[model samples]
Target: RHQGFFRLDPHVDPISDGGNVFILGFCSPTVMSLTPVGGAMGSLMNQRAVSTKSWAAKEDIDVLMEPRTLCHLHGDARQLLNHGIRMGVDAAQLKKQGVNVPDNASLYDWWGGMTSPVQRSPMRLSVVLAFADVDEIF
Candidate 1:
């Protein structure tokens, strides 16, 4: 079991284990209990490329996954993309901070029964394991 929020800054994980990281979300009926209410909702992925000596996000590759899902990143996807959790900000809050939000923008209009602002979740329990792929090691 893990405690507190999981707001990670986007970057390539150290991968010192020479293995991929696996994430599982345990959020369910209490999903709304996420810190910031709707903030920290899901996970985000962005394409990354080398810019001289540093890596930077390339445009047009943004993606977000809803809460309590399973995902694995391997090979190029693991090494060449920056990943992190999404931070949710209420339109009201944004307005209070002087950012413009259309008064009519209610936002949560998913077609089906699912609704979440992309890759986001406030907290989760993570178990890390390492194993060198035999093919990669051989």
Candidate 2:
């Protein structure tokens, strides 16, 4: 599984001034399902409360983060979206939830659509490289 975090803002964090920031995420080959569990601490426009939200909550994009795929986030996307790979869903649990599981597909495959039960790969290993613009490093 893969997860990304964005912690900035000068008032909250002394190490950051919340300036220009970017994140480069590198996914390994073992990644099969890239489920986004979004819940960032921020207030949306017209929204009264600061609730957990994410871009995936609004979009229905099916593009999985395949092996060797590079994910880039900057500015608004970096600060707003909170992405993470979801835990494996058990077969029985899916059925109990009234989810339709295909005969030939496993619970993970039914949700992720990348791998089958037997063909399921290992946990994903990812590396995050962060960059911040600054005049001096003190």
**Pairs that collide, model 1:** 41-120, 41-121, 42-119, 42-120, 42-121, 43-119, 43-120, 64-119, 65-119
Q: List the residue pairs that clash in candidate 2.
A: 1-124
- Model 1: runs farther than 4 Å from truth? 1-5, 28-68, 91-123
C-alpha lDDT score of every prediction, in listed order: 0.37, 0.34
Report residue 48 deviation for candidate 1 (angstroms).
Answer: 21
TM-score of each: 0.47, 0.42
**True-structure Cα RMSD, model 2:** 9.2
Q: Pick the candidate with the highest lDDT.
A: 1
lDDT of 2 by residue, 100-124 (tens): 5554333242223322221123344
